[model samples]
Target: MAESHIDLGVVTAPSGVLVLGMASWIDHWPQLGGTLSERARASASIGGGHVHDWMCEMVAVRAAGDRPLTVRAGTAKSPLDGGPTIATLEIDLGIPWVRTAGNEPIILGDLPVDRCGMVLGDALALDSWTGDGHPSTDGLADVTYWGAHAEAAHRQFGGELIPGRGNQVRGWLDLPLDDAKSLGDALGDWTGDEQGRGVMVAVDEHNDFHSFNRASRTHPLLIGAIEVADCPVLGINWDSGDHSMRHRGERPFGQVYPVTLQPDRTGRTTMRWTIPPYAPGHDGPE
Candidate 1:
């Protein structure tokens, strides 16, 4: 009997032999069962592709699945800007359990199943999370990753990102047109996934915290209130009202660098930090 149709985003093409996450090229890619290829014609744009579409290339024929049906794929651009290369890939199906991601239809290739246990980041993503209404697999990263990519692409190519927040906390940071290269480089590693994953940054006057979470793109920090500085940085002790349960999302204890011409790498960067629900010290300082 034909398997129940699973919406693979756009159309329900028969559940292909593989399921993959679509993204720009990464220098470090995963390896597949069969030979990999670049320059795909109908490559699926599942996660995010606008950012690297020009700088990075595309791929297909990565039907490579593992005994456990694990797969990984990525691409990267060359200095010449000739095209992005499919790189940094690996898939080990040694896991005892083998099942599709919630039985939802995924790409034929592009699995995250790792034999030696999932990576720290992957483990966090794969873990079941329900602090709020967000499930671990509910595209939390997808929201963060593609959201930023789309914002960047729209600003660079189409124009300033839409759904603006008056002052534009999430739009293009007054970067020189030539700085597109630098911008892309700085944001290349940014991803949308923010599940069990967490990071702590020191807070300081010279720093300005920015929530890449597109949900808070219009956040007062990004939008800037009258009292707040133009670029918002997470301070050790910030205004409770400002930091209060933003959309019920967990706030990062660390701060991001200030939006200054020169980054103050001195004592004003990230200070102390921690990921919540997993308090560092049982009864340590709050």
Candidate 2:
């Protein structure tokens, strides 16, 4: 018997999906030089308007339903039909491939789906823009839907899954920081720390050939750690340090092209996910 290399399934995009994770979150951390509120007051500001206006504009732009609401899903099979590791999500938001399950199951989905489900049934696309937001580099759907779903669950299960309606219960409706941190903290098991120390290091792809696939852009990419306690997330950016996922912080590992996400405040939200481990020296997974 040989290990199964691929598992195929249908994960719904819900026809109104926008960005995944905090992919479109604009950084407003008060410490990284200053918060978005301060940037508006800074003399260096070129347009002579409060930076928040741009953020508001961006948020509005993303919410206008202008992008696709499709999510790509597939599975990772083990050698042979060894079943699956049934990885439970301690903190999984926009997983690339997953299914809902029943009874006692190892994998999230009950049985392996051989075909698409009701979620995949294409609804008449009402518009070109599904909602305001951007997609993750890895292309996951906005998982902030968790909040809406959580609310519905609370009405039924009442204190079974989570205590309350995510950030709303966490008091993060209109935060001052980038929406990414809030989206992550919405998991309720994590805390966010902003960093002013940034870096950009080019790694040798060694003819990986996949290098050409990277989306090219001109924003200063920063490399820093978002410590979800022991799980430190390393990220890259190419947008003007304005959004979270777009943070072009360069990484050294060409091998680990890791990116996970969750929905942010805007419609084009981020669906948070996990990052692969990086080699560390002194500062853990920096």
Candidate 3:
């Protein structure tokens, strides 16, 4: 049988349901090589403010009313690279069901009023904006700092699945670098579990201010392996340095060898990700 595929773009149902994923226009795309104020103003512009540029592991859907939902495992290609399948998930949304057969089924209505954020027959929505005023990125160019903020937002807004919530967790973790040697030692000591989990280590590389931003002296470097189980789409900036995704085991998965920035390219750097061939245990593209 042919494999199924889900449209990663914005999806809506006739029942007043709206679904927004990473591909949806949620936030403004940051411009490359400009003053913080200039960048902010450019982002606020209509054409500049919103773009489908984020690459993520998870897919978020907003459902409405008491209508049931159906989710199926399928392959989605990254619009950034247009290369290979990124990730697949299998889930079904329907009448309340129990995972185990023996345990007494819990009643949905019996749940506490405060806990039942999404009551039946109510519309569901997700607002990406936190409503907090944008912070100054003036002297800050560290990707880790931004990643930390993203993680914090996810936690503060009650996780990614909560309806009407503003934040979605991207699973960004920080690896403290104790010293110069620690960087090498950490890479050499990476474990199989980490590889299977598809963790990427980002290193800062120096670059010209024109290439990126005045505050940022270096481009972002990403290293490690990627798989369908991990973040399917690995986001990258246009001026980002060379990145490597190496697999340890015999089996092959999504891996980007080395993607370097091209100085000739002009305008804002478009968010991008390299797609690899679909691996075992993942659904192939239709």
Number of the top candidate by TM-score? 3
lDDT of candidate 1? 0.23
Model 1, residue 112: distance off in Å is 5.7
The runs of at least 3 residues in candidate 1 whose Cα sits more than 4 Å from the true structure, single-residue gaps closed, are: 1-8, 11-17, 21-27, 30-168, 173-286
- The lDDT, on a scale of 0 to 1, for candidate 3 is 0.24
Q: TM-score of predicted model 1?
A: 0.18
**Regions of model 3 farther than 4 Å from truth:** 4-15, 21-24, 28-64, 74-124, 129-286
My TM-score estimates for the predictions, one after another, are 0.18, 0.18, 0.21
Model 3 clashing residue pairs (backbone)? 28-49, 205-218
Candidate 2: which stretches are off by over 4 Å?
1-68, 77-286
Q: Which consecutive 10 residues in model 1 have the weakest lDDT in total?
A: 255-264
Instruction: Give the whole-model CA lDDT for all candidates, comma-separated.
Output: 0.23, 0.23, 0.24
Candidate of highest lDDT: 3
Worst window of 10 by summed lDDT in candidate 3: 110-119
